[model samples]
Target: MRILASLQVRLPPSRLFAPTCPTRLKSFKPLFTSPNSDLPLDGDDDPDMTDPVKLAFARAEAYKRQKLQAQSQKLEASLSGNGGSNAALENPSSSANQGSRASQVSAPKGKPPEAEIIVGDPTKFENIRRRGEEPEKDDGETEAYRPKVKTWGVFPRPMNISKTYGGGKVIRPGDILETKEDKEAKEQRSRELVTAYKSKMGLDVDPKLIAECQKSLKDGNELMDRGRLNQALPFFEKVMKDMVFESELHGRAALQWSICLDSLQRSSEAKVMYKKLQNHPNPDVNTKARHFTFSFEAMEFMKVKSSYLSRTTGYEMYFDSFVDNKEAYTSAKTETKEAGETQILPYVVFLVSPLFVILLIAVRKSFML
Candidate 1:
């Protein structure tokens, strides 16, 4: 019994000390699987997860984007070239830009502007060059709309002719009519045309008036060149009267009139005119007038001196009355100097006679001694 009990205890100890089989940890599986998942059937196999459709779609989209990018780069290179065209290259049309991007990307290269017909009607090509209009893309369709250009013409009608239910004659350019009434009407029309363009013709200088004034001025200058002051004065005066407000003409007329007056021996009137012109608006006229006044006054003063000298001497004057001379006083001065030389001859005779008497007394004393 002791042996049996020892065996039983040993047996229990052995059983307790015996090695046990380790249970393998259950393999963990994620609820969401990868594309390459390979699961078995009946939840006992891995799933086969390969998405060929999605891969094909992704590759196709990448290729399309790459092609578009390449096309855009080519267009950019063309536009950056030196010979690049400027035919609305930077198109401002919003409508054209909002259309299909493919159409915009496929737009053709434009030609140079110098090669285009810019002078003709753009509407014939179904184009309008005005601003604020929509632009169209080349979609292989003819344009259906274009703006029209208009030109206006002149349609002149007769003036001052009362209209009636009767027929009238038509007048044309360079038409010849053999009637006095027609000539009068033609002249009237010419006058009307002149009146219409009168302002543009320059009021102070009409063609005919300028011709007349120029002729008169030319004739007056010719006469003046010939030293005919009297004839020149009248022509210049007529010019002044024709154009009264012309200060140059007025001054010239006044100067010529004074010149003629002086030539006619009318010193008082010449002096009066010159003094009046001293306050003239033109500086040249005033200076000329002042010189003339001084000259006249000098002549008058010299005349008074000559008259005094002639009266005091009680001799016939050397100068004549009819001489309209400006240098007359200078000649009178030479004559007065000659007269003074003659008065010195009387003093010379008296001195010589006294010397002779002294010589006679000296000779008698010497002979008596």
Candidate 2:
């Protein structure tokens, strides 16, 4: 009976303990729970925690507190006398007062508070008027003074009419005007120049075809100017197809097309096209071609200049051969050095040879004696 009683004492009162502990935990849970019980305490888990409006309000409150602290510090500093502190104190105090005013202003019924304005003190401007009664001092130097020369007199400057629209010899009242014959001769000369240019460019195609080509070229140029190289390529290609080879227009078309290709990173094709222009009849075309080609070549040279071997071979093959050759050369050099070091000394050879010869001669003389 005692054993049974002891066992019962030693064992916990499970019913009572479980019920009481759980009751206590349940009671404390509400106290430890977050204010919004539906949302988690961790900021990342709560969707509304990062709301922009709430963040903005927090920032504004923080800024306001900082501004109030700064204003107080500025007021304190102003009470202390320091040489450069006067300007600094006035500026900060005015700014602080403006900040306080901004903070005190009420917002509209449904809107957030307006941003604060911190005004700096107005800049002090000193009056710096020169006295008219002051005597002017003249240094005895005349080199600094240069007299201005008149570029135009009674007649206006002559203008090159061909180079600019609305440019010609300026006429005053009663000036002799160009006669009809002179006008006709000038027009005839312009027509001949146009004809010659057309012949040079092989632009003697049908008017409709020429117009279409010109339009295409114009579109291509516009696209190129706007940095749309890919879009320009088709128009340029169309014009190039219609242009006769070696003609001035064809050379221009090809050059422009190659430039577009180069800009687009189609380097190999651009290089090939540029090479074709090397034989161009026009000196300008040939010069331009050489310039672009050399530029590309220079870029390529810089790219490969650091490499020990040419880039023509595969990396695997080149690297393997280089490593093998290097290793073989190093090993051969080491072996040769070791062999030279182990070689018999010239002094030892000279001493041994003389001693053996003397011994042989002494033995022969002793036998004869």
Candidate 3:
């Protein structure tokens, strides 16, 4: 028993509170060792210990440290007024505030962009004269000097009325001064009247032919009123050739024929017909035909005049030279007045003559007794 106890003491304590073997324990060391150990803990300290994730983290930390150092150097330089590059670097807090303000400015709620205004020199566009600038004079063209005439008094000088009428000195209020147009119109009318008279005596047109021509002219006029110029042209042209020039129907047919020719673009033929109609014996026909000879633009002006005159004055006279025959127009009024006077005279005579005859009979009976 003594020998077995000694051998057990000599043998190492049971592996409960101590390692099994010193050499084995040293061989199977922990992954993390003492802090003072020379072996690298991170993979960056040892180039041979390559770990992708750890190497990336180590590189990022180094880059961040370098960037901070550079930013601090820049800030110090700006504060010292040595570097003109980075003004914001001198005050980072204010720069951050300005950046936020810029972001807000870019984000407009719902407003349109402002309109850009452009200012330029007006003198570059046009030649403008200044107030104090002198006007340029024309070369070799001096203004003509006119002598002022003397005036005796403020009242106007009297015109010699006798000098105008062969020194007769007779002034008439109702006398009308004839214009060139009026004189020409009167001469044309006289010539037309003479031609009409000669035509009536020379041409022995049958009454039946005149009646048929008048009927044709009336039908043509009705077609023209309905805007059927094409259909009316043939009828008007036929009547214009067959009708006697002295007849009133001839003037009407000639005027309608010229109007159709104008509408059809036969301007040359229309001009000839209008020239002939200008000297028509009928006043109404001559005036209407003369208006057709005017320029198209002038005719439009006359149309406005005619409308105004027709409204204001119950008569439709376009030209100032055209005059209506007042004697013919007043014939009916004169006849009515004469008829009334004759009727009164007849009643007066019937009443007085009986009295006269009775007195005469009484005188004769006294003489016989």
Ranking of all predicted structures according to TM-score, beginning with the best and ending with the worst: 2, 3, 1
Q: Clashing residue pairs, candidate 1? A: 37-47, 38-46, 38-47, 39-45, 39-46, 39-47, 40-45, 40-46
Q: Against the true structure, what is every candidate's RMSD?
A: 26.7, 34.5, 29.7
Indicate the TM-score of model 3: 0.27
* Candidate 3 Cα RMSD (Å): 29.7
| Candidate number of the best lDDT | 2
Off by over 4 Å in 2: 1-203, 304-369
- Identify the leading candidate in terms of TM-score: 2
| Over 4 Å off, model 1 | 1-207, 300-369
Clashes of each: 8, 0, 0
lDDT of each: 0.59, 0.65, 0.64
Which portions of model 3 miss their true places by more than 4 Å?
1-204, 296-369
Query: Considering only N, C-alpha and C atoms within 3 Å, which residue pairs clash in candidate 3?
Result: none
Colliding residue pairs in candidate 2 = none
Give the 10-residue window scoring lowest on summed lDDT in candidate 2.
19-28
Superposed by TM-score, candidate 3 places the C-alpha of residue 41 at a distance from the truth, in angstroms, of 99
lDDT of 3 at 229: 89
